[model samples]
Target: MPRAKDLDTVAPDDFLNSTLKSPLPPRPIKKPQNKKIKHLHQSSNGKSHSAQFRQNVYGILGKTKHPFSSFLVKPKVFNFRERDTDEEIILVLRRHWITNLTWILITLSMIIAPILLTTVPLLESFPPAYQFISIIFWYLITFIYSFEQLLSWYFNVYIITDERVIDIDFNNLLSKNFSEAKISMIQDVTSTIIGVSQTFFNFGNIQIQTAAEVPEITFEKVPNPEIIIKVLGQLRQEEELENIEGRVK
Candidate 1:
């Protein structure tokens, strides 16, 4: 009986030991924890850093629509004058009618003189060679007149602005004279409509006296000299007002 009792005790102990040696419930097969990912973008202030960056970029780029108004540095009070809201101004030119008439008269003479000389009974007795030479001369004169007309039209330009005046004088399309004077430096302005032709045609010359090194500025053969003078006087008055108000620079 003692031996059987001891054997039963041993078997129970071996079973308990084998059970303990066996793996425990696989420890719930714990998986490695995934690391949390951090975002690269973050706010500097309460506002988004990206939004602030875009705002800065916009200010640097400036307004695209109104180029004239953008990024203008305000002038000092003493230097300030009437500002030119419009950078460019009315640019007048010599009337096309005057040039056309001059060319037309020359062309008509060239055409009519030769025909009259050839067709007239008194001139028909002239030598054929003389007539041919005369015809060629007349055509040559016509060509010269046409060339001059083209050159005059091509090179004539006048520019007027609140800030300054520009006169581009081109003689024969090859030699050119460009003169400019500031509106503020203008001391005296004169307009002359001398002859009956000038008065009838409403065109004349305007002379401007300046304080600059160049003593005088003349606008020759400009249409409506009186109107130009008036416009200039108005601009000068505005400039004076602005100077008094400390708005011009």
Candidate 2:
């Protein structure tokens, strides 16, 4: 037999028998993955772009997605003045962007008309200063029109909460009509998608018949009308269940 010193220098494989199996490599320790939530939770104290607004929520609403989205599920930043402390907002909706195309096209035409015409035939008769003022006034009016249209789109909203349905008609900065009805009061919900654009964009009108002070609430040119109806239906069912349980008590 070889000396112990010689055996130690030899490769382990040279003396290996089947019984001396190599210890299995330690099992890899996997790093845990963090799963992201798709919707905002009220308790999470979410925030939006506005500093005053503490409702911030984002779900794949990246560069490709509009920040002022037409549809948001479990929105965290929206809280109407009348919102109850415990009321949880389920959805926030604005009119589909396609609805603004007509005004946007008009605005674009107005912007380019002066550039294309170079000089207005009417302005030719006026002094240079007067002509400049006229041009400025035209551009100012164009800006106002576009700004108003954007503000209307941004402020006007339809909201769905656990307990109620809300509609806000933001007519202007200072003037808005706020309307709401309890989810329990909803009697019927109907959705209508009309026109090629509406159909293609999957946006339409939602007509809600309710027993509240406002008999009917219509969401015009809103995206995902069918989904809104379905959500309402589910809420109605939940409300009915709660009523039944309350009656039993």
- For each candidate, give its TM-score against the true structure: 0.54, 0.71
lDDT of 2 at 139: 98
- In candidate 1 the C-alpha lDDT for residue 39 amounts to 21
TM-score for model 2?
Answer: 0.71
Looking at model 1, report the run of 10 residues with the lowest lDDT sum: 69-78
lDDT of 2 by residue, 31-99 (tens): 665443423332132222222221221222212234488887776566788888877787788999888
Q: Judged by lDDT against the true structure, how good is candidate 1?
A: 0.61
Best by TM-score: 2
RMSD of 2: 18.6
> Candidate 1 at residue 103, lDDT?
74
Off by over 4 Å in 2: 1-67, 120-122, 247-249
How far residue 50's Cα lies from its native spot in candidate 1, in Å, is 39
